[model samples]
Target: MPGRLQHKAALITGAGSGIGLESSLLFASEGANVLLIDVNVQAAEKVQKLIAERYPNVKSAAIKADVSKESDIKAAVDKAVELFGRLDVMFNNAGIMHPEDDNALNTEERIWDLTMNINLKGVWWGCKYAILAMRNNPTDASKGLHTGGSIINTASFVAIMGAATPQLAYTASKGAVLAMTRELAMVHAREGIRLNSICPGPLKTPLLMDFLNTTEKRERRMVHLPMGRFGEAIEIAQGALFLASDESSYITGTDFAVDGGLSSCYVTATGEPTLPPPSSLA
Candidate 1:
């Protein structure tokens, strides 16, 4: 018996914590050789240790990588292939929220640039190098691994729906993520490389907790949520797993929303267990 990602190699950025950490662990459970990349070296090592303890049967590595930096990205990718012999997947999950609360009108030039560099440009770099490395892999006839591989990007539901909050820089960066996914999907579709974005809704991750600690802010945020609760990192990891595995062979240039129905819900649609029938009396 073989696993869903048996014999495959995966390089996941932001794998130090939250959704990235959950994804790296889940991928290993499914038989992927995971390379955990993070800007925080200690956190990455911590996750790597946890993986080793839990999944002794699978191979895993950790590398400190600032995804916004090209040299760091290159070194991490190179390290993965050097240790694993091939690259089959790239999960570009590293991203940041703007340090300031800047809307389009008042958004600081520096903040916008920083957000775009990390969120958008980082994915572009990951796809560029991952595609190159995957193309060079030797085809394994046994598992029908003749094709290159897949790329999963961490986008946001805000990319589709305008922010119910105040972060413009994050919105713009994630919008670029959706666009990049589509364009990259088309560009390398011929190469058998699939690229898609995982647009997560509000999650109970430390990143979110750090931003919305106040009771007022947290309550305000929770009201808009149809599910009335934040999602878990593991829930989003399952979405990434679907995209990373052969399961999504036909999926590309798409935004897979793992937002607990947040992206698809409308304000008026709330509290309705079912839709009303067509009004014949109207």
Candidate 2:
């Protein structure tokens, strides 16, 4: 049998590491031609080479692009179309959590602007161009490929729930992403397009790990996790895969939380999880 995303084209931002890297590999494994976009050209190229070797039948390429720059986003989307003939999935997953980002009084204007530029504005540009490209996607009924595509923005659990340890700008930016995704999903509901934000809890990725560097910092958030463990990047990738594929055809405009019950918990249980975290493919 063919893979879930066989013959589909996907463009992923921040493909160098963390959730983006895992998603790129997973998407390729499922037979989607992938365009990996990242500021780190070397990292993106490494993933592209791995995809070429592992999933030889699927086309994969890497491009150096900063998600904060609109032109770069447009170029990446256009490249996906040029390579795969259409864009079926756009994962606007690139974002940052500045170490300096803290409470309103402590966070600097530069930090705020930088976080918003990449986290919020970058997602906006990705959605804007992806929609334009997806609008003209060539339909192929036999393969289940359609004109409209799915867009997944990486939001955070903090967007929906408040965090005592504040990364104010990061939280605010993600909240905006959730809102933007909802409105866009509504606007394009009739156009066969789908938009949804995937909200992830604290993960063992480099991004969050760096921020929670000290043991005190780590424990501060750990006390609240019902699972008693940080999530893996691959876990979020699985959620992105479902949203990208037709399996989630009925889902759109929703805040799909892949959090480990973090958002829903009032008081976390005290034990560690028996099940092991999902292993990374990258």
Candidate 3:
């Protein structure tokens, strides 16, 4: 049987590590041709090689690009079309959680700008170029190809809920992403394109691990997780997979929260989770 994303083409930013890396692998496993974009070209190429070895039938390539730059993002999208013949899915997963991004009073202007550039503005650019490419996508009924595509932006649970230990800039940027996704989805609903945001909870990714360096800092957020454990990158990647596939054809304009119930919790339960976290490496 063919995979869910059979014959489709996907472009994922921040493909070097964390959720982006996991999503790229997962998309390829599901039979989509993948273009991996990241500032760390070597890291992306490493993933490209792994995908080639594991999913030999799928096409995959890596390109060095900074999401914050409009030209770079446009080139990445163009590369996808050039290499794969169409753009079926765009996963704007590149983002930063600067260690110094604290509450507004403590966070500097530079940090705020940096966070918005990568997180908010980056998603915007990705969506813009992806839509342009998707509009001209050639129709191939036999292959289930269409003129429009699915776009998934990486928001955060913090965008919906408050964090006492605030990374104000990160939270605000994510909120903007959610809003932008909703409006775009509405605007493009008439067209075949669909737009949505994925809101991930605190995960054990390098980005969050670096911020929650101390046990005290880790525990502070852990206390609010009903799962009593941080999430995994694979978990979020699974969510992205659903959004990218035709399985979610009717789903659009919503914040798909794969947050381990973090957004729903007022007070977390005391017991530990019986289920172990899933790993992409596994």
Residue 98, model 3: lDDT of: 94
C-alpha displacement of 16 in model 1, angstroms? 0.5
- What lDDT is reached at residue 8 by model 1? 92
> What's the candidate order when arranged by decreasing TM-score?
2, 3, 1
**In model 2, which runs have C-alpha deviations exceeding 4 angstroms?**
none
**For residue 241, what is the lDDT in candidate 1?**
89
Write candidate 3's Cα lDDT for 109-204 as tens digits.
Answer: 999999999999999999999999999999999989999999999999988886756799999999999999999999998788999999999999
- In terms of lDDT, the best-performing candidate is 2
lDDT of 1 by residue, 138-256 (tens): 89888767658999999999899878677898898899899988998999898889999999988888888776767987766776677767778888888898999998999999999
In order of appearance, the predictions have TM-scores of 0.92, 0.98, 0.98
Error of 3 at 122 (Å): 0.6
User: Which runs in model 1 stand beyond 4 Å of their true positions?
Assistant: 268-282
Error of 2 at 29 (Å): 0.3
